[model samples]
Target: MSIKNRLIAMNFFQFFVWGAWLITIANFWFGTKQWEGTQFGLVFGTMGIASLFMPTLTGILADRWINAEKLYGILHILYALVLFYLPQIETPGNFIYVMLLAMCFYMPTIALSNSISYTALKNSSDSDVVKDFPPIRVWGTVGFIAAMWLTNLSGNKATAYQFYIAGIAAILLGLYAFTLPKCKPQHTKAEKSSFAESLGLEAFKLFGTYKMALFFIFSMFLGGALQLTNAYGDVFLDEFKNVPEYADSFVVKYSTIIMSISQVSETLFILAIPFFLKRFGIKQVMLISMVAWVLRFGLFAYGNPTDGLWMIITSCIVYGMAFDFFNISGSLFVETSTNAKIRSSAQGLFMMMTNGFGAVLGSFTSGWAIEKYFTHDGERDWHNIWLSFAAYSLVIAIAFAVLFKHKHNPNDVANVSH
Candidate 1:
C-alpha cells in the first residue's frame, strides 16, 4: 500500500474503535442495564479521568523512550483486552473502574495517533501536511460513521456485541500499527537534559503564556460540552418510543444511525477546517464553533421525530462544526505554535484539557445536574437538559471572545498546511 493509504487505514480504524460504542453506550447503560444516571455519567467520565494523566504520561514516553507506533500499538492491545472484559460486568458501579482502565489505554492513543499521522505525512517526500492530513483524517470520521452503522444494522446497538466489534477492530488496528512507518522519539538522552525536561515536561510551559493558557481553559469548557450529546443523544431520540405518537418514527427505531449524521457531518467539516482556519484566524473559527454549539443545543431542545424533526436534523448537522472547529483547529494551533521536540507532549496537553479536565467537568457535572434537575420519575426532560447546556456554551463563547487574544497571522495559518 502507498503511504497515504496506510495512514488512511490507520485513521479509519482509529476512530472506528470509538464510534462503535461511544454514542450508543448510553443505550447499553440506560436501556440494557437500566443503571442510575449518576453512575452512567461516570462511565463517560472514565475517558476524562484517563485523559487527565495517561495521555501526558504516554506523550512523555513517546518523546523519550519508545517509538510512537510501538507505543500506540501496545495501548490499543491493552484497550482491546479491557473492552473484551466489559460485557461481563453486571453493575454500573463496577463498570466504571473497568471502563476507566479501557480509557487509559485508549485515550492516549488519540494524541499518539495524531503524532503518528503528522510524523508520517511530514516525513513523506513532496507531501504537504496542511494539505494532506485533513483528507487522511476525514477517513477517521468515515470509520466512525461506519462503526455506528454496523452496530445499528447488525442489531447490536443496545447489546454487548458493540464491545465485541470494537475489541476485534482494536486488535486488528493494534497489529496493523506495528507495520506502519516508524515514528521514533524526537528527544534523545544524548541532549543531556534535566529531570524536568527529560520527562517531557517542557511542553507544560505553554501554560505560562496567557494566550495558550486561555485557549486550553476554554478548550476545557467546550470539552465539557462535547460528551453531552454522545452520552445522551441516542437515548434522547430513543425515548420517543415511549410516546405512542412517535413510537413508530424512523428516528426512534434507528437512533444510532440518526446520531451517525453528526459523524457524517464531521467528514465534511473536517475538510473545511483548512479553509476556515486560513481565512479566519484560529480564534475566530473557534468563536464560530461556540456559536454553532448554542444553535446545536437550542435546536435539540425543541426537536422531535415528528413536526420538529428538522430541528433534530439541523442540530446533528451543526455538530460537525461544533466539534471539528475546536478540536482540529486547536490541535493545529498547538502544532503550529509549539517546539517540535515537545509537540507530542503539547498535543497531549491539549487532549488533557479538552478530553481530560474538560471531559471530567462535563461528565460529572452534567450527569449530576441532569439527574438533579431534568430527570424525574425515571424520565429525562431532554428539553431543559439541552437548553441548560446551550446556556453553558453561550457563556463560554462570550468569555472566550473577551479573554483570548490572538490576531490572525497568515503565516501561522500558513504553517498549519505547509
Candidate 2:
C-alpha cells in the first residue's frame, strides 16, 4: 500500500477501537450492570485522569527516547489487554480502575498517532502535512462510525462484546503500527538539555503567556461540554423506550447508529476547517464552535425521536461544528503558536486540558448536577438537563468572545496549507 493508504488505515483502526464502545458503554453500565450515576460519571472521567499525565509522559518518550510508532503500538496492545479483562470485573470500582488503566494506555496514543502521522507525512517526498493530513484524519471518524454501526447491528450495543470488538481492533492496530514509517525522537545531543526539558515539561512555559493560558482554560471548559452528550445521548434516546408510542421507534432500536451521525458530520466538518480558519481566523472560528455548542445542547433540550426528531438530527449535525471547530482548530492554533522544540509537548498540554482536566470536570460535575438537580422519582429530567448544559455553553461563548484576543494574519492562515 502507498503511504497515504497506510496512514489512512492507521487512522481508521485508531478510532475504530474507540467507537466500538464509547457511545454504547453507558448502556453496558446503566442498562446491563445497573451502576450508579455518580460512579458512571467517574467512569467517563477515566479519560480525563489518564490524559492528565500519560500524554505528556509519552510525548516525552516519543520526543526523546522511543520511536513514535513503537510506543503507539505498545500502548494499543496494553489497551487491548485491559479492555479484554473489563468484562470479568463485576463491581463499579473494579471497572473504573481497570478502565482507567485502559485509558492510560489508550489516551496517550491519540497524541502519538497524530505525531506519527505528521512525521510520516512530512517525510513523504511530495506530501504537505497540513493539506493532506485532514483528509487522512477524516477516515478515523469513518472508522468510528463503522464500529458504531457494527455494534448496533450485531445486537452488542449493550453487551461486553463491545469491549471485545474494541479489543480485537486495538490489537490489530497495535500490530499494524509496527509496519508504519518510523518517527524517531527529535531531541539531539547538540541542543541545550535539562531533566525537565528532556521530559517535555518545557511546554508548560506556554502557561506563562496570557493568551495560551486563557486558551487552555477555555479548552478545559469546552472539553467538559464534549462528553456530556457522549455519556448520555444514547441513553437519552434509549429512555424514550419508556414512552408507549416511541417504544418501537427506530432510534430506540438503533440509538448507536443514530449517534453515529455526529461522527458522519465530523468527517465533513473536518474538511471545512482550512477554509473557515482562513476566512474567519481562529478566534472567530472558535467562537462559532462555542455558539454551535449552545445550539447543540439547546436543540437536544427539546428533541425527541418522533415529532421532534428533526431537532435531534439537527443537533447531531451541529455536533460536527461544535466538536471539530474547537479540537482541530485548537490543535492548529497550538501548532502555529508554539516553537518546534515544544510542539509535541504543547499538543499534549492541549489534550490534557480538554480531554484531561476538562473531561474530569465535565464528567464529575454533570454527574453530580444530574443526580442532584435533574433527577426525580428515578427518572432524569433530560429537557432541563440539556437546557442547563446549553446555558453553560452560552456563558462560556460569551466569556470567550470578550476575553480571547488574537488578530487574523492572512500569512499565518496561508502557512497552514503549505
Model 2, range 1-418, lDDT digits (tens) per residue?
9999999999999999999999999999989999887788998899999999998888878877788899999999999999999999999999999999999999998888877777787678888766787889999999999999999999999999999999999999999999999888887868887887865688898899998899999999999999798889989989999889999999899998888889999999999987888788999999999999999999999999889999999999999999999998898788778655665677788989999999999999999999999999889999999999999999999999999999998678656443
Ten-residue segment with the worst summed lDDT in candidate 2?
409-418
| lDDT of the candidates, in the order given | 0.91, 0.90
For model 1, where is the 10-residue window of minimal lDDT? 409-418
lDDT of 2: 0.90
The digit string of per-residue lDDT tens for model 1 on 1-418 reads 8889999999999999999999889888877988877788898899999999999999988988899999999999999999999999997778999999999999999999998888888888867777788889999999999999999999999999999999999999999999999999899777988778976799899989999889999999999999787788898999999999999999999999999999899999999988898889899999999999999999999999999999999999999999999998888899998866887899999999999999899899998999899888988898999999999999999999998999998788677544
Measured by TM-score, the strongest candidate is 1
**Model 2: residues >4 Å from true position, as ranges?**
none
